[model samples]
Target: MGKIVGSAIVSHHPGLMQCEDFRRMMGAGQDSDLIAGYERLRHKIEAVKPDVVVIFDSHWFTTGYHLVDGGAHYEGVYTSDEMPWYLYGVPYNYRGHPAFALDIEAVSKEMGGYNRAIAHSGLERQYATLNLIKHLRFELSDTPVVSASSCQNCRPEHFLQSGAVIGEAIRRSDLNVVLLASGALSHRFVDIDWKPNHPRIFHESNLSSPENLASDKKAIALMQDGRHDRILEDWDSDFRKAHWEAFGAHYLQMLGAMGGAECRAKGEPLSAYENARGTGNIHVWFDA
Candidate 1:
């Protein structure tokens, strides 16, 4: 039988792909360490030996229902429509486990999840999904992937319900699954002319502020302590102040899918606190 062998929440910044060149020009080498850290996480993922990856893409904001990518295989030269200058000419090709994705879709509807099928490979790939593939070196392996969209209209309760349904699907399947929640912690973007001297730009809702960083720390602390219920409760007010991506919905899904599996999770901080267009970019892996 299939099971959720592992799960993770990661930042999928577009700059990650071109960090070497981008950071070198700005006289900063922090990105090299960041890249290596992700390399280490990739090794950890390999150790799990997952057969398929179910990615929750924060950028794939579906309007009506939760859209699941159903393509048998995905292949294309990806250029980020949101930030083409950074991600242009990026090539990605990955096989898709359509059968597994279809099962997820069916199971979702059975549990009252507003799940819909999206089977086209040509649809623009979001950075959150593509960047994870890039950083994890997923293309190097043949493990198929399916992407789940973030429902724009989903309430916290409904979204959490949806996550539970997905967990049930994974449990019933015969494929070993790894769940990836793809997004940043804070998401206020810089709206300024970026210069090499002031390489790090700040959003008006500044990310580097002591309060924001402290809140992020608290949030991470909760995750490390396996206090997912606390995150779910505090996300709307306290945690949301830090401007988590999708109001921390991606992380909620990651936690919810654990099925209340009580674990005193040990975590690894994979990336540094960098600025991705004024958003706070960091990767912390909480082992399931």
Candidate 2:
């Protein structure tokens, strides 16, 4: 049986990687606390020493079926199309595990999650995985990695089932695996015209509104109390706004892969941030 040593939900905004440049662009205070939280996660990762790190990216939208990054050599120069000004010409080099990509595809097919392969050069990984890799010490050659796509037409149920298949694939393999759910909690944004030194934005960011804060707090509490089922049940409609990122599918994958019923929140906050647009960033660790 395969072993799962670590699992977490993280924010992969390009701003996280280019905090200084982002601050220069947005004219916001330095986010020292948010940096500390991610640093803590980095420490935990080193302790885990996983053989493979599987990333579930929110920005990677596949239409018909789930997709996996199947390229064995992941070396590329990344320039974010969304925010090229902040993250331009960033070099990312890593090793990929193509064999396990096929393994996950087979297991996903068995679990009714048809999987596709994205095996080629010139395809840039989304910031969700790239930002985290930039901060953490896990390199491609040191520890091979793979990425899973978030199907645009999928529901929370579909994501959960796909996550189960991924977990099963990890179990049948000999590698020690760690999982990452990379996305934002509340992803709504305001107008992009906000200049530097805006009063509404700061280190300890206030949530967009009280309702957004409450919704995010409740979501985190549910995770802390080991209420994975409630997340699966109320996510699509409740505990979230219509604009929340990935429809909370990122958390569903983390919850499902770690151990569906057995997964529980450790009441430990990994990282939390509210961007200028009122998007809530959360990083939580789930016990397998």
Question: The CA-based lDDT of model 1 is what?
Answer: 0.73
Model 2 ranges with Cα > 4 A deviation: 19-29, 194-206, 265-267
List per-prediction Cα lDDT, in the order shown. Answer: 0.73, 0.74
Over the stretch 117-170, how does candidate 1's per-residue lDDT look in tens digits? 789746878888888887787899877888888887877776666677778888
Screening candidate 2 with a backbone cut-off below 3 angstroms (N, C-alpha, C), the clashing residue pairs are 2-171, 95-140
Candidate 1: residue pairs that collide: none
Would you estimate the TM-scores of all the predictions?
Answer: 0.89, 0.90
The 10-residue segment of model 2 with minimum total lDDT is 195-204
**Error in Å for residue 176 of model 1:** 1.2
For residues 1-288, could you state the per-residue lDDT of candidate 2 as single tens digits?
777888888877666666565555453444534567778888787788888898888888889887889998877778888898878887888888999898988887677766666797877688878887877756733777788888889777677777888888888988888888888787766556644234535332444566776777777888788787776667657665635678767777766777675666564677655563567776777554
- For candidate 1, the 10 contiguous residues with the lowest summed lDDT are 196-205
Q: What's the lDDT for candidate 2?
A: 0.74
Candidate 2 deviates by what RMSD?
Answer: 2.5
